[model samples]
Target: MEAPAYQRIAATFRGRIATGVLRPGDQLPTEHDLADQFGVARQTVRAGLGVLVGEGLIVARRPRGYFVREREHMVYRPQEKSRPRPAVPEMDRFSEQIAATGRTPSYSIEVALIEAGADLAERLRLDPSATVVARRRVRYINGEPTNINDSHFPIDLVRDSEIMLPAYLARGTDRVLAELGYAQHRAIDEIFVRMPTPDEVHRLGLGPGTPVAVHFDTGYTESGRPVQCAVNVLPGDRHRIVFERHWS
Candidate 1:
């Protein structure tokens, strides 16, 4: 059986983009023009464009036609029941893990501050208005924006530590915490799916119709004190998150 016309059109455009014939920010021809060029109907062109939009390969402007957008690839691995925990020595190691799964890992940190917020205070069991260190980062996989993570930790615990220092910002919190004598013994993760916020759509370069995966993780020290609280938003189409379970 032959593939559908729209799928073929989509594949053609995708190949062009992948081969650099259509670079990021390059404007695509009008739908009518594409229809004429491909000897297809306007709807076929629209369908092709929709595929590109869903793949984060193009963006449509109100007056302008579609333009090439950044693309990313991501994978989620289930924790192995036999191993219990993978030997991830540092946060950078996670990026390496993502790369090993055949996706590129890139990230940018936006905000890292010591401030007091209702959520952080409650999570850390601190008095209302007590200060904590907040860090926000956007992680990219294979050059595509995939997740926005906002994390908070008690300031008193990390103020003078290497984790708060700019030089160690890229090292990730897990390693720094371990060095500071508060190694994480366990983590609880809660995940849900929802539509992306308007701000998230723009900042994460998502299509208007794309939904996001929300992941909440709380890390605890062996003594049971909460060490960190993180909220991560992942683009739905680009990530495949998995969780493994075991019965003892």
Candidate 2:
């Protein structure tokens, strides 16, 4: 059986994109033009373009036509979370990483005392309605929103501590937690890929068809006491998760 007109159209544009015939930020031909070129109806052309949109290969900028999506990926290594940060007087680890890459990093941070939600309550071993200190940061790279790092800590563990402050901790919250005697001896990292929530979309300034990888990092003390549960939201197109291993 012959392929449908829409599939052929999509395949043609997809090949063009792959071969660099169409570059990022380059707009597709107008629907009328594409219809004429493909010898198909305008509706068929729209259906074809929609396939690329769903695959995140292109974006529909209405009032304008669709364009190839641009992508730049930052490396994210989960294994490094438990390692000691450099002994520098930097504000945070994320900023340091970006700086090392010759880019600027900034954040919008806010501290909140919120009731523990079900996921956090279980992770932190807290009672329902227990107050938790939520240190939320919408991290930015070169003035563009990049990711969300919202960490939740048990109130008792972080109350009256630097973690309660909405300002950046020069040594980061992890070191502060250690000073408070809740040093994280181990952590469990889980990554989930899904469609972004509306809040996540707005916070990260993500475009349509962009998914996210939600990293849940739960930390425990040497005695197995849960102390911190961090929720890091990473936009899919903006990050690449990496892991390195050495055979024992």
Local accuracy by lDDT, each model: 0.75, 0.89
Q: Mind giving the per-residue lDDT tens digits that candidate 1 earns over 184-211?
A: 7777777889888889988798775578
lDDT of 2 by residue, 1-248 (tens): 98999999999999999999999899999999999998999999999999989889999888898889988999988787777666776556677789999999998999999999798988898886999999999989999999899999988888789888889777878888888998989998888999999989888888877999999999999999998999999999999999888999
* Error at 112, model 1, angstroms: 2.8
- What is candidate 2's CA lDDT for residue 11? 95
- C-alpha displacement of 1 in model 2, angstroms? 4.6
Top-scoring candidate (TM-score) = 2
The runs of at least 3 residues in candidate 2 whose Cα sits more than 4 Å from the true structure, single-residue gaps closed, are 1-4, 18-26, 62-64
